[model samples]
Target chain A: MDNIAGHKSSLTWAVHISVALLVLLWLLPTLGLLVSSFRTADQIAGSGWWAAPFPQEESLQLRTAGPDEMTQDGDLYVIEGNLLEQNGAGDLDISAWGTSARDVSAYAPGKTAEMRGGETMTLEEDGTYRLTSAEAFEGRGERVFVSATVPPEFTLDNYERILFSDDSREGMAKAFFNTLTVTIPATIIPILIAAFAAYALAWMDFPGRALLVAAVVALLVVPLQLALIPLLRLHLSIGIGKGYMGVWLAHTAFGMPLAVYLLRNYMVGLPKDIIENAKVDGATDFQIFTRIVLPLSFPALASFAIFQFLWTWNDLLVALVFLIDASGQTTVMTRQIVELLGTRGGNWEILATAAFVSISVPLVVFFAMQRYLVRGLLAGSVK
Target chain B: MNPALQGVIIVVLAVAVCVGYFWSSNQILDRVIFPAKGEKAGQNINRANMVRPWLFLFPALLVLGVYLAYPVVETLRLSLTQRVGSGYEFVGFDNYVQMWNEPKFREALLNNMLWLVVVPAASTAFGLLAAQLTDRIGWGAVAKSLIFMPMAISFVGAAVIWKLVYDARPLGQDQIGILNAIYLGLGGDAPQTWLTIPFWNNFFLMAVLVWIQTGFAMVILSAALRGIPEETVEAAIVDGAGPLRVFFQIKVPQIMGTILVVWTTITVIVLKIFDIVYAMTNGQFETQVLANYMYDKLFRANDWGVGSAGAMVIMLLVTPILVWNVYNARKEMR
Candidate 1:
């Protein structure tokens, strides 16, 4: 689209800026979740994820070491500690400090606050604090409030808790495995089934082949909500029941139309010369399909596999209906994330981590096989 | 056995069985049932060819019919019948009547209409914009993939992502949600809980769909735009058509068919959009769409009659597209 007139149209910069903005808009949400998953619960609640890379300025409440650590020095009992050092936020720089909640941040760092019991507490910007009194400090210690700017922190603890937790109910490991269990068979079986059907429709001389193809196209847009009740009843009555078998069958059935549609579309485009030459060589239709056409239709098959994998893996409704039971044993990642959303709505650490775990596989597949995905989209929508 | 090990074994076994079924059936037809050798060898071969396509198509056809085709009819039947004790009695139109009377269903229908209008149009417009703009830039493919990235993320995942965007905290606290922070930053009096606000929240929900689907629209429309006749575009520009004029008048008109395809494709997606509504709002706060409504009737309320009726409504809405598609396929066949 470069200007042949060589006038250097001003629209180019406008286009560049617009695309930059669009890319950022598209990337920010997932970026936020990815950042949040590496943060702790307190960090998420304290500030928005957009501030993740910057230093966090927060107010902290800390206590000096107990009266047991006190010593008499020149007619005074004293306790000394660094609030930031004790809390392990040694990177933090205190901006303000105070001795009571009512007067939080009443003084700048290094100022001393006079207590009612004739005790004096002095805090410095480096978080070092001194507690001195004529009598030894009582109970715990003098409470001090510090408003400080702490350096950014990130952690792998969220992943550890979600993936390696002892309780199966809390961890994502089982659901992750269950999702894989549903996805792999659902992907592979449909390709073989759809490929054979596609080969038949594409090359075979048969009555009603066109009608079957049209029916597949019609079935392409049939919303699966209509399949819910009837299929559930079928599952229960036939004793397929809500588990791995039932969900796999449901996924296969649901994925069949597009599988056949995409594969047949690609297969039909396969040159007539090859199939006819194979037939002329005395190869069976089965041989022609498996030997020549199956290998030839790799792109279409790959496209469908990725589609079925993502659909069956990310599926919540189908899993909810046919796979997941009241026992929560057959739960998949999507279902687990939804459950987290319900029970741990405010727990962004868990929600973000589980959501990320659920989406990460699809994202990996998506980026890796994106070419096939896009090609499938273009081919599938051609008609 | 450990559950993971059990899952792995089942996966292995299932794959083996499916493969075995395909291979053994074809092997049986060839080796045992109709071996292409005999006194009537040609006859056997001819018979074998006739039976073989069905063998190829049988598994897929069986699944399509039993899983997809039967459900359309069965769901239709359930809609007209009321459940009795261990049986169903035919009561035509009663279920539809009950479903129609519910305020929630009405709200759902209204909201689905809103979605149908907004999501496809907004997605298409933005997609066209992205497609056109990116082509004029050097880093278009990189930008397009980033836009298309959301298509891979599940709807539940998207709901979680957007929930954070629409998240709100009370005033006088550091607002955690991006929208809230922006709202407060822009000097809005209070942070709006975007999802809970009525009348406008639907747009917030729709924005998530828009954000996700714009990539799809962009990808399809970008291809369509690339497929445009360069000569025609050149001729348009030769006549002093401005850039916008060339776009709206020339480029868009040529790709109108693809645009319609993108629109209809997204329309189908919008109709079946369940996870977003289910996860974010659960159809509360006047955000009920028909799919969620049907789910509510079937699962939560345990009303099969009305649930089936709701399903039929969605089916009815889709019938026109099905007919159009079948008609198109038949036309293409001829």
Candidate 2:
């Protein structure tokens, strides 16, 4: 008994390790993209996102006032001012100043320079300096090095552009709405149709009942691409080609087989006693399906709805093949993101924000409806 | 009774009922479906009936028939005909013959074969592993949800995500793609097009499908794994089977049926896959599969005979699996 308990704990540990690794593997890229999306273009161009958040030293050129600003006061030509802004841009003290590029930042901002011919110069912290030279300011611009602390600044600009701007040919906002239009109906239609079909297949007794279910399963093998052109031809013939309606129909057609198969499996797994009781109460097939099966099959419907919605929402091929046009009215999130990659591929913020926008809906759907997915899948599998 | 008269009467009745139902339902559509003025019926009171089912089903079936079923038949017919624009002359099995002989079709067929074998197996294995691992952990639900999150992202979406991971840059630029960066970080030379590599590129492309589908397999397998009676495992413990042995010997056999179902389901999906290949690489770089091949032939090249022939080949290839699924489903029903 002790050995058995020991073995079980060891097994649990093993499971934990493996699960942790799998979750990490799944998360790494998405996290990377998310992080990269928030970074500025120059930062992204300069280093990997993994290198972000670390401090590094950088060189910059600074300038001080020339000898012209110098005044002959008392004995010394004193420069009185601050080298940095006190309130807004901040008090970054000047490290050094010099005349040549090589000797830039050689002297502190407040240091007075003693020239060979009794010439003098002084620089203060407020970027003002007095160069008390017997001669007027005749030299080139003064160069300086100031150690300025660059803070990590994040922007919502990428998101703003992806969501609001029309500059990107493949902006995610249009695609997002396009995906929504395609997915909402695609998700709802399949569930609606599949619910009825699932009911009829699960509970309704009719001639050729098994055959209809079999046909749907057969359809599970019919790859949409194989039907793409033919379907398009049929769509054009029927005048529903190349639009939201066409893509919706395409998704529904593609989505139906699984939806029916899944919902039917879930519906069939439902306790027979409830369905039997409904039938005995003189409820017709349709009534029992609506009143009894649908509500009880909420787990399955919701689960399937989530799956369909996500797929349709994330779909690009169906949209590309059927919905996309030059007018850009039918552009979807996936297509827009793809176009962004092609055009603004270097723009991490645009790409990541666009990606996030595209996935945001699915994320919500998954999180909110995830429990039903587990319940629905288990409901179909357990019994 | 007159048989012809009875047939006519039945047709007349079906048409009359349909017309009456439509005319009445137009008024009720806003009331029931759209629900104006907050008069919508609640769950208990709102009822669907025999007539309502047909009404709900009509538009769907019509759309399916026009867009789906009609094209399916038209594809089959188009396989036998040679098309010149909108018109076609029947050419019989010549298209089929030509497709069988075409080198590109053969290559696509082989790529699909690789996709079918590798993708489903790898996905199932990973999913099963993940499911097994998650089942023992305290945070199993969260872990499973995270892994399953990709399933919600569409094929094109996954491709988009992978594109960033596989984005290749020439030397001297910041590497955006992780894999290429790794190679370059290791002091490698130029970035290679991963999706464009021949034969093996198929497996690389298959990895995308595996990633997207692993969630599906994990979810289904996780459910199936949960359904494995705890009593059985406990009983196996009394027999002294180690954890690994117990998993293989007891748990695996118990859920074998579900595994086969999951594997086959993904197999069917893999067979129909055109989106990932189309979206990521457009079937270039020796990654072309049968479906995309069909699209190119039909849409790009305008070779109706070859396209139809390719479609037929896919249909034939997929039929056996479809039959197997149907058989299993029927058996499960029993």
Q: For residues B158-237, what per-residue lDDT tens digits would candidate 1 score against the true structure?
A: 99999888888888878878888988898899988999998799999999999989998998889999998899888877
lDDT of 2 at A77: 51
Least lDDT summed over 10 consecutive residues: which range in candidate 1 chain B? Answer: B1-10
Fnat of candidate 2 is 0.41
- Model 1 residue A112 CA deviation in Å: 2.8
Task: Report i-RMS for every model.
Answer: 1.5, 8.4
Q: A1-383 in candidate 1: lDDT tens per residue?
A: 44753344567877788899989988988898999999988788889999988888777888788988888899999888787778666667889988889987899988888988798888888888888999867788677888888677899999999998977766999888888878887777777778888888988988889889989999999999999999999999999888888988899899999999999889989998988999899887777877899888889888899889888877889988898888888898888888888988989999999899889999999999999999999998855
Q: Would you give the TM-score of chain B in model 2?
A: 0.80
Instruction: Give one digit per residue, the lDDT tens place, for model 2 in B210-261.
Output: 8878988898888788888888888887887677778899999999988988
Top-scoring candidate (DockQ): 1
DockQ of each: 0.72, 0.24
Best by TM-score: 1
